[model samples]
Target: MLSMLRLTVITLLLAPQLAGAESLVSSLSDEAIEITSSFTGSRIVVFGVVRDEQETLDEAEYEIAIVVQGPESEIVARRKDRIFGLWINAASQPFFKVPSYYVVHMSENFSLVASEELVAQYKLGLANLNFVRSAYSPEARGFADAVIDIRRRENLFAERPAAVAFLAPNVFRTTFFLPAIVPVGTYRVSVFLFRQEKLLAAKTENLDIAKTGLSDNIARFARAQGALYGIMTVGLALFIGWFAGVIFRRS
Candidate 1:
């Protein structure tokens, strides 16, 4: 009887943790990225909510993190340099920066949440190039601009919730400002939810910058292309009909 009672007590104790793990749910409001220019730095904002299944737990604590990856070649070179500096060629050191993660606790009463992450600071000289002229002019004109640009880039920060709250469904939002000097390429935004150092949920979104424009003009161009094709089809039919009538009448 005592062994059976002990088993029952253990089952009850472990039930909540298992339920909590399954109950934790999160989602981003907007996962697609929109950028205006490839040469210029831009900002990305993420908004979403986290919800808990159990009503009994009125509050929960969590941590958030943003990870920025450097250019692949640079990252590989850096790793090699760190392992074997002497064997590697004496090239200029590549730049890499990582953001510190944020942690907060919240009660169940709160629902809306937000966070932002600026990625330009992770790379050197990315926040300094003028979005308009950098593509054409690769040289830095003067020292003052370089210094100011570098300073501006270093101050960038990732977005986070204004306040933390309980494990209830809530809206979260964040904004990121990218500088004009950032490279014209793809980037990533990651959101994480942690319960006292243990990661409970996570999401990642990809951001891309186009040299012509932030998002491809596919919708706009598709409509025009459709119309053009329709016109050509009609014109071809008419020509074939005319040629057939001409040949038949003559025969």
Candidate 2:
């Protein structure tokens, strides 16, 4: 309740600034996400407002796309082949600049209404994402398909059409879920405004997903001192084994 009130107030205060051009502005419900031991999942709400010169245009005349994207990574997709009745990796394709998580929400049915060329130009879908090493073999549904399928099944990527709901004439909002396994990194939330299927204005905001509490300290240490972490793990294992042997011998 409070968050919505705050958003509404902020939007009202910022409306005067967006009057000159086809202005687009947006905000996130939470700028930062903290991952703790008990964090199961979280929801992200994106609030936006589109302003234009025309006063009588209905909300239906505008097409809005809200995208939440996580950090970039290089992913490898491997194909398994049966060799002597054993499944093993036979071929692999590397995907560069892959987002750890990605989801797009649209105000209308963009897939049916928008042209392929326009969609590609805007990079609205997973298929339109920039790929450096693309094994785009449609017949085999190769690496691109494999990567998309895996991410979708894991709830790391999605495409939602007609998901943006209007709050007022120019005010709108969209929501997306972050799974328990959401990657910890800086994310980008982008809101795009379109009219007659043409992009007019765009806005972006940053979101940080991070570990907290004892878990955060451990993760920081592990990442900063990988060799020391490995050595400590081996030492702990040895100590545990020795202690177990001594207890068994006494028994």
Q: Which residue runs of candidate 2 sit more than 4 Å off their true CA positions?
A: 1-21, 28-30, 52-60, 109-112, 136-141, 234-251
The residue-by-residue lDDT of candidate 2 on 99-188, one tens digit each, is: 999999988645457877777778888877776225556533567887888899999999898888877657777778887788899998
Q: In candidate 2, what residue range of length 10 has the lowest lDDT sum? A: 1-10
Tell me the lDDT of candidate 1.
0.37
**What do the candidate models score in CA lDDT, each in turn?**
0.37, 0.73
Residue 109 in candidate 1, Cα distance off native in Å: 16
Candidate 1, after superposition: displacement of residue 71 in Å? 4.7
> Tens-digit lDDT track for model 1 on 1-251?
11110000000011123324422233334433344433344444444455454545435544444333212222111112343546554333222232221112122221133211122222212332233123233332233234334444553322223433223344444445555434445555555454443445544455443334533354345467988767776899999999999999999
Number of the top candidate by TM-score?
2
RMSD of 1: 18.3
| Model 1 TM-score, all chains together | 0.39
TM-score of each predicted structure versus truth: 0.39, 0.80
Q: Tell me how far the alpha carbon of residue 166 in candidate 2 is from the true structure, in angstroms, after superposition.
A: 1.9
What lDDT would candidate 2 get against the real structure? Answer: 0.73
Stretches of model 1 off by over 4 angstroms after superposition: 1-19, 22-41, 56-58, 68-71, 75-91, 94-169, 213-251
